[model samples]
Target chain A: MAASRERIREVVDRYVGLVASGTAAEIVDLYAEGATVEDPVGSDVLKTRESITAFYSALEGLEQRTRLLAVRIAGGEAAFHFEVQTVADGVTYTLAPFDVMTFDDDGRITSMRAYWGDDDMTIG
Target chain B: MAASRERIREVVDRYVGLVASGTAAEIVDLYAEGATVEDPVGSDVLKTRESITAFYSALEGLEQRTRLLAVRIAGGEAAFHFEVQTVADGVTYTLAPFDVMTFDDDGRITSMRAYWGDDDMTIG
Candidate 1:
C-alpha cells in the first residue's frame, strides 16, 4: 500500500512539476495515447502525440504553481483533486481541476480524465 | 460485491435526489452530524445539524438539478464527480461540482466534502 501511494505521488509530482515549469508537453508525457481530458467545453480523447501538443496550445495562461489537493488510488485507477493558478488575457484566474489517471503495470499512464472550469477563481 | 455497489448507488441517488428537489434539509439528512465539506473558501467540519442549514442557506441561485457525474466507493470513503446547474442573480450558470462522502457501516453519511466553482457554466 505504501508503494502504491509513493507511485501515485510520484506521478502527481511529475505532472505538477511540468505545469509549474510551464511545460505542458512534459505534463502530456504522463498521459497514454488514448487519454481523455474532460471539462465544461467537452472531453478530449487523444490518439496521437501531435494531438497532445494541440491540446496544450489551446489552453492559455498556465503559469507557475499548480497544486494537487488530494489523491485516491485503487488498482490501475487514481483520482486527484487539483487547483491550477493561471493568468489569462492579463487577468489572473484560479481554476479547480480534478483528474483521474489510469496506469499500466509499467507505470505509464493509460488515461487522464480531467474536470476543470476557467471561471473557478477563489477569493482569498 | 454487487451489494456494495447497490449500497453505493443508493447513497448517491438519495443525495442527488435531495439537491434536485431543492430540499437542502433532506440533503443534510444524508450526512452524519460531523461531516466535513470542503470548497474554495475553506473546509467545514460540521459538528451539528444547524451548520448544514447555514451552509445551504449561504448559497444563492440553487433552484434545481444537481447532477452527480461518477462515484467510486471503497470502505468508508466514496468519491463522486458531479455537475450542478443553477441560475444566480438573473444569470444562468452551470457549476461542475464534486463531492467525497464518508459513511459509517450503518449507511449514514458521516461527511460530505464538496468542490465547486460558480463560474463553471457549460458551453452547451
Candidate 2:
C-alpha cells in the first residue's frame, strides 16, 4: 500500500473548502455516518453523524486554518500531521500539536485524533 | 480487531520503562528497526533502529512524563492520544497534542506520528 500527497491533498482540500466556503455539509461529507472525533486527549469522544453536524454548526463563524505539516502513506494506510487554528466564543483555540488522520479506501477520514495538551491549555 | 487498555498499557509500559529506567535498549525494544517517527508536523522523519536509539541518547538526562488520555482499537489498529512533557537546556517542552500509533500483530509500534505545533511553539 502507498499514500500519495495528491490523495491527502484531496482530503485537505475538502477540509479547506469547508472553512473557506463556510459550508457545514462539506465537513459532514468527509466523515461517515459513524465517524468519530476526539480532542487532543481523546476525552470528548463525539460519535454519530448528528453530533458531528451539530459540532460544526456551533462553529459557524470560527474559521479553521490548517497547515499540512506532513503526510505519508504505506501499508495501505496514511497519516497526516497538522496544526489547526480557530476562534470560538471570542477565544482563539490554536491546537498546534498534531492530529493523526486515517482514511478508508474511499478516502473518507475514519478517525481524526488530535495530539495536544488537556483542556487547560489554549492558544490562538 | 479490538483494542484494550491492558494491551495499550503494555506498549506504554515499555515506553515508560525506557524513560524511568533510563535503559536505551528498552526503547529500542518497543519499536521495529525500520520504524519511523516524525515530529508533530511530520517533519524530521527519523528511520531505523540506530537513529531512533541515537535520538533518545541525545536526551540522556532529560525526563519524560506521559499522560494516557484516550485509546480506541477497532479493526486491527489502535490510536492513543496523549500529552508529552520534557525539559531541554533549561527549557520545558510540552507536546501535549497527540500521536497516532499503529502496531503490527506482534504488538510493536509500526508508526508514530506526533501532533503538536511546529518548532516555533515551545511550552513546558
Candidate 3:
C-alpha cells in the first residue's frame, strides 16, 4: 500500500515545524531506524541514525528558520524547495536548497538528499 | 547585479513551454552556449550543447508532456518539481522529478541537474 499524498505532506510540514522548534533528538525521531541523509547532493551520505542526529545536533543553537516555498508529493516521496535563514558571527545568511525526501510505509523519512551549492548561499 | 526573480521564472516557464510544443533544437536554444546538464543527479554530465540537444531529441515523437507542480526562484537560480507523462511500447509511464536549474547573467540556463531514481518511476 502506498502512502497518501496528504500523509506525505503532513509529514513534511511536521518536519519543517520540528526543525523550527524541536530538538535534534526529536527531529531524529521522525526518521526510521536506518535512515540516511545526503545534504548538498555530492557530499558524503550520513548513513546511520547517530550520524544524522549529530548533524542536526550541530545546528542546535544556530537560530535557524525555514520557509517552505514549494512542495510536491507523489507516491511515497516528497520534494520541497525552501529557504533557511540563520545568524552566525553577527551576520545573517540565507540558504535556499531543494530537498527530495523518501518516506517509509509508516510516514517516516527513509532518505533525504538536498541539492544546492556554495553559489546558493546569500550573506547579509 | 543579480537577475530578477521574475526573469528567472520566465525563463523556466518558457523552457517548459518550449519542451511541450517546440523542437529539441528550440529547446536547446534556451540554454547558454556551453551549458551542462546532469539528469538523475549521479549520471555523467552532458558537457556540450550538442549532446544536450541529442538527449532532448531522443524524446521527440514520444508524446511527452510535463505538468509543473511547483517552482521556486531565488537570485539567479530556479528549482522546480514536475510530472512527466509519456507512453512507450504501449505502456504509459509517469516520472516525477525535481530539477535544479542555474541561470547565467543573461537568464539563460547554465546548468541543470535532475534528482530522481528508478523508484520514482511508475508504469501502467
Candidate 4:
C-alpha cells in the first residue's frame, strides 16, 4: 500500500518545522534506514544514515527559518518548493530549493533530491 | 557538455508559452526522440512520441492559460511549479503541478515527471 496524501502532507509539515529549529537527529529521524539524500541535485548522494545525519547537522548551529511554499503529492512521491532563510556571520542568505522525495508505505522518506544552484541563492 | 542554465530557462519559458497556445506537436517538439512523460506521477509513463503527443492533444481546443510559478535548475535537471487554468463548458479548473524534467546536452527534455493529485486541483 502507498502512503496516504494526508500522511505525506504531515511529513512535509514536520520537515519544514524541524528544519527551522529542531536538532539534526530529529530531522534524520523522518527518513527510513538506508535512505539516500542528495541536496542541491548535483552534489554527491549521502546513502548511509550516519552520512545523512551529518549532512543535516550542518544546520544545527545556524539561525534558520523554513517555510513550505508549495507541494504536490502523488504516487507515494512528493515534489515541494520550500524556502530556507539562514543567518550566518551577520549575513542573511535565502535559498528556496525544490525537492523531490519518494516515501515508503510507512511514510518515511526513502530518497530525496533537491534542485537548486548557485544562481538560486540570494545574499543580503 | 551539460545544457547551460540560460538554455534551460529558455526552454521552460517556451514550454509555458506553448502549452497556453501551441498544438500538441509543437509542445512535443521540446522533447527528445525517445523521451518519456509521466504526468501526475502515478499514471502510466508515456514512452513513445505518439503516446506523448496524444496525451497533450487532450488540451487542444480547451481555453487554457499557463504561468510558471517558480523553477529551479540543477545538474541538467529542472523542477518547476506551474499553473494551468482551463475553461470548459463555462467552468474553470486550475491545477498547479510540480514537474521534474531531465534534459539532454542539446537542451531537449529527456524525461518529465509531474506531481499532482486530485487534491491539488481546484474548480471554480
Candidate lDDT values, in order:
0.60, 0.60, 0.80, 0.93
Runs of candidate 4 with Cα error greater than 4 angstroms are none
lDDT tens digits, residue span B53-120, model 1:
67765553366567776555544456676666666566666655556566766667776655443333
Per-residue lDDT of B16 in model 3: 72
RMSD to truth, every model: 14.2, 9.4, 8.6, 1.0
Which has the better DockQ: candidate 2, or candidate 3?
Answer: 3
What tens digits encode model 1's per-residue C-alpha lDDT throughout A5-123?
A: 45756887787656666455766777766665543223445656677767766653455467876555544455677766666566666766666566765566766656443334553
lDDT tens per residue, model 4, A1-124: 9999999999999999999999999999999988999988988999999899898998999999999999899999999999999998999899999999999999999999999999889999
Highest DockQ model number: 4
True contacts kept of each: 0.00, 0.00, 0.04, 0.86
Model 3 clash pairs? Answer: none
Q: Per-residue error at A119 for model 3, in Å?
A: 0.9
A35-87: candidate 2 lDDT, tens digit per residue: 78775434677888887778777656766675655543433234444556776
Ten-residue region with minimum lDDT total, candidate 4 chain A: A34-43
Interface RMSD of 2: 9.7
Q: How well does candidate 1 score on lDDT at residue A105? A: 58
Please give, for residues A22-99, the per-residue lDDT of candidate 3 as tens digits.
799998988988899987665789998889999889878888888887666654677787888888888989987787
DockQ-superior candidate, 1 or 2: 2
Candidate 2 has an fnat equal to 0.00
Highest TM-score: give the candidate number.
4
Q: In candidate 1, list every pair of residues with a backbone clash.
A: B32-B109
Query: Which consecutive 10 residues in model 3 chain B have the weakest lDDT in total?
Result: B69-78
- What are the TM-scores, per candidate, against the unseen true structure? 0.47, 0.49, 0.59, 0.97
